[model samples]
Target chain A: LAKTTQPISMDSYEGQEVNITCSHNNIATNDYITWYQQFPSQGPRFIIQGYKTKVTNEVASLFIPADRKSSTLSLPRVSLSDTAVYYCLVAGGSYIPTFGRGTSLIVHP
Target chain B: GAGVSQSPRYKVAKRGQDVALRCDPISGHVSLFWYQQALGQGPEFLTYFQNEAQLDKSGLPSDRFFAERPEGSVSTLKIQRTQQEDSAVYLCASSPPLAGASNEQFFGPGTRLTVL
Candidate 1:
């Protein structure tokens, strides 16, 4: 099972692009990196997912290097409402998809 | 379309009390999952069901924690003799059966269980 590690917390100004990186050095070959955003009192929402290279959606972009050991979640032009916890998960291994403490992003205006 | 919905929104139970949490997944969803999220922690996978069959339940903390999806759409997670350690937000998620693709799981607002 691969374990993910990320910054405990981060602060960014509004209207700036925010990038949070997660490291999963022991990720397996079949594991795919997925990112989720969670707000207070709600469940986590899927942000972006990718296996290699980059994957972008309307909300965010996920950049995964070739080695697949690390991935970055980029939120363009973050707003105060973007403040939340972001989790990076490595799925597809024998272990169930688990979540770490995640990086708490605080977007300040 | 309606996303996953959990019943009661919040639950407060005394220690040793039994409580049942409900989940209604999106229509036609083939997969359902349950998770436990404690304060200042990320959600932890509890169990997973593919339609009517429960495929994985290794994450269940103990025998007191039980879950069932009899008809394949609605699920119920029952905690017997609840402990303070079980106090947390119980989340339910579902994903479509996208063959060979890693389908994104949609989550519910979750039922916050506070065992005092």
Candidate 2:
């Protein structure tokens, strides 16, 4: 399992675009980037995932550079409800995934 | 279909007491996982079970913590002699068959355990 590093906290206004970046310099060949969002008292919800380049979904977008050293999660038109702790995980096929202290994004109205 | 579900949304135990947390995975799911989340921290993997077989428990904090998934469906995590540090949220997650490690994992609302 590769270790992940992300900002401790970020603040964004409603209707703005928020990008959270994660760094995993030791990412392996089979490692994939996944993002999850957790609100207070709720389980973390899957947001987006990507292996390389960009992957977009109805909720968010994930961008991975060619080096795979880092990844970014983009949330567009954010609302106050989007305020939550976002986790970036790098995992491979073996099923062992580790989570670090995530980035807490505060979306203010 | 219903997503994962957990029992005892909140539990408060005196120090040294035992507590059991339950998790019900989605129907027909093949993988179940237990995680511990401290306040302001992300969920930490505690154990994993592929069906009824507990494949990995290396993340379990100590022998006091035990988990079992019998019949490959409902799973239970038991904590013995709970300490203040054990006061955290226990999360249960399940993934569909053939889902990759990075695949979406359905999570339950979680069991909030408070050890006083």
Candidate 3:
């Protein structure tokens, strides 16, 4: 499993764009970058996933650089409800998904 | 369509007692996973099952932890001799066949266990 490093926490205001970056220097060739959001008293929900370059969905966008050493989760027009802990995982092939401590994002009104 | 479901949303157990948690994956999902999440921490993998076969149990904390998916639909996690450290939320997730390791997982609300 590839170890990921991210900020402990981040703060943003309503309508602001939030970007959280994760570093996985040991990422394997087949590993895909996946992000998940977890709220209080709830299970983690999948946000977005990408193998390289960029992938966008209705909720968020995943940006993976050419080297694939790092990835960023970009949230547009953040709202108070977006406050949650975000986890980054690199998994593929036979490797099981491993979650790190995650970055807690607090969206202020 | 229904998603993953877990029973016993909350449980309080005394130390040294045994406890069981159950999970129902989405219909036709072939991959089931069990995870443990502590307060203010990300979930940790406990085990994985492919259909009726137990594929990985390496993440289980100790011998006290056991899990099974006998019929390839419903799964159960059993913890014997629970300790205070065992207090955490047990989550279950499932993925469709051919989803592999990187696919998105549908998660249940989870069972919160508090061991006194």
Task: Candidate 1: give the clashing pairs.
Answer: none
Model 2 residue runs over 4 Å out of place are none
lDDT of 1 by residue, A1-109 (tens): 6899999999999999999999999988988888999999999998888999999999999999999999999999999999999999988755377789999999998
**What DockQ do you compute for every candidate structure?**
0.60, 0.79, 0.78
Model 2 chain A: weakest 10-residue lDDT segment is A90-99
Model 2 TM-score is 0.97
TM-score of chain A taken by itself, candidate 2: 0.97
Tens digits of lDDT, candidate 2, B7-94: 9999999999999999999999999999999998889999999999999999899999999998999999999999999999999999
Q: How much lDDT does each candidate structure score? A: 0.91, 0.92, 0.94
lDDT of 1 by residue, B1-116 (tens): 57999998999999999999999999999989999999999999899998989988998999999999999999999999999999999999998875122558899999999999
How well does each candidate superpose onto the true structure, as a TM-score? 0.96, 0.97, 0.98
Model 3, position A109, has a per-residue lDDT of 90
RMSD of 2: 1.0
Model 1 CAPRI rating = medium
